[model samples]
Target: MTDVTEEFRLNLAHIDGPLAIATLTGDLDLHTAPGLRTGALEWIGQGHHHLILDLRGVGFCDSSGLSALIGVWHSAKQAGGALELAAAPDRLTRMLTLTGLDSLLTVHPTAQDVLSTHRPTADA
Candidate 1:
């Protein structure tokens, strides 16, 4: 498990096609949400709209994490893009599902699944 005390780190990469994926580790709370937002926006601004977030290593997530995701979704949508979650832990899945976000956002069992199979919808 990652040290929860440390700040979350965002790692970026491009998979097949223009899909830009960010793998997040550590806790995603209010303090780190802004950075997450900025990083994602920077990628989107660069003409990368397909996003896959790998959250399997995330030890903890608060409202800030959820908020950050919502913000990314809205921002990506405005640019005609889509954001999908990959390898979300059960805790995160439960948290998102309880709030009905599971349906709104695509959730995959693993990053590879999202990377290989995800096709952006027409509406984005």
Candidate 2:
């Protein structure tokens, strides 16, 4: 059988405030995981204190990709920021749940939820 290959794309957009969103497309395997990590760190380095990963377009993810995510989460926390995943695929969610990482990594139903939940209160 011939081998099939997938292209990975990571796109970042900064919202009106301190929030930045990274939209990932294609498979998130060992080859693509580095791109995701680089994109996220680039945004954080740009002074974005809050990050949301939009994984709706991600069709596949392997252990390496998940490990990269955990690393990114640690980077965010060390920078005094937070990382959240929005619209993660069912398979990814199940993996996180089974591995007990669902609690460590915040998962939101939608990007809007990420914004609303992390948005700074008026009093703050």
Candidate 3:
């Protein structure tokens, strides 16, 4: 069995005030989805609510990965923050649309675009 971390990488970066960019790489499957969820939740817990998931490097994402995304969105929302997707692959976008998650989660063309447009206020 492949190690979860070996198959996936989640790099968190703080950009544009309260916004956090989680740049994910590699396949996001059942083996690695939990780590993504946990890392995002930890970031949110630390008061970084506004999150942008940079999925450009993500080559594959399965149902479990989608579920983790939803869970992260909910966690961010509950923390008075928002979640957005940047540079998602075409297949992931299609899956999101098919599952109706596209409506619930905001998708941006690129992380730089999101940084330019969104200016989230710091939590008081």
Which lDDT values do the candidates have, in the order given? Answer: 0.83, 0.83, 0.87
What is the clash count of model 3?
Answer: 0
Q: Candidate 3 — which pairs collide?
A: none
RMSD to the hidden true structure, all candidates = 3.5, 2.5, 2.4
Residue-pair clash count for candidate 2: 0
Tens digits of per-residue lDDT for model 2, 6-119 = 788888755645568888889888888898888888877876757889999898888988999998888888877788999999999999999999988889998888877778
**What tens-digit string does per-residue lDDT give for candidate 3 at 6-111?**
4689998665556789899998889899999999988888778899999999988888999999999999999888899999999999999998999988889999
For candidate 2, which ten residues in a row score worst on lDDT?
115-124
Where model 2 places Cα greater than 4 Å from the true spot, the runs are: 1-5, 121-124
Clashing pairs for predicted structure model 2, backbone only:
none
lDDT, model 3, position 20: 87
Could you tell me how far off, in angstroms, the CA of residue 95 lies in candidate 2 after the best superposition?
A: 0.8
Which candidate number has the best TM-score? 3
| Candidates 1 and 2 compared by TM-score, better number | 2
Sort every candidate by TM-score, greatest first: 3, 2, 1
In model 1, where do residues sit more than 4 Å from their true spots?
Answer: 1-5, 15-17, 119-124
By TM-score, the better pick of 1 and 3 is: 3
Task: Report the Cα lDDT for residue 49, model 3.
Answer: 85
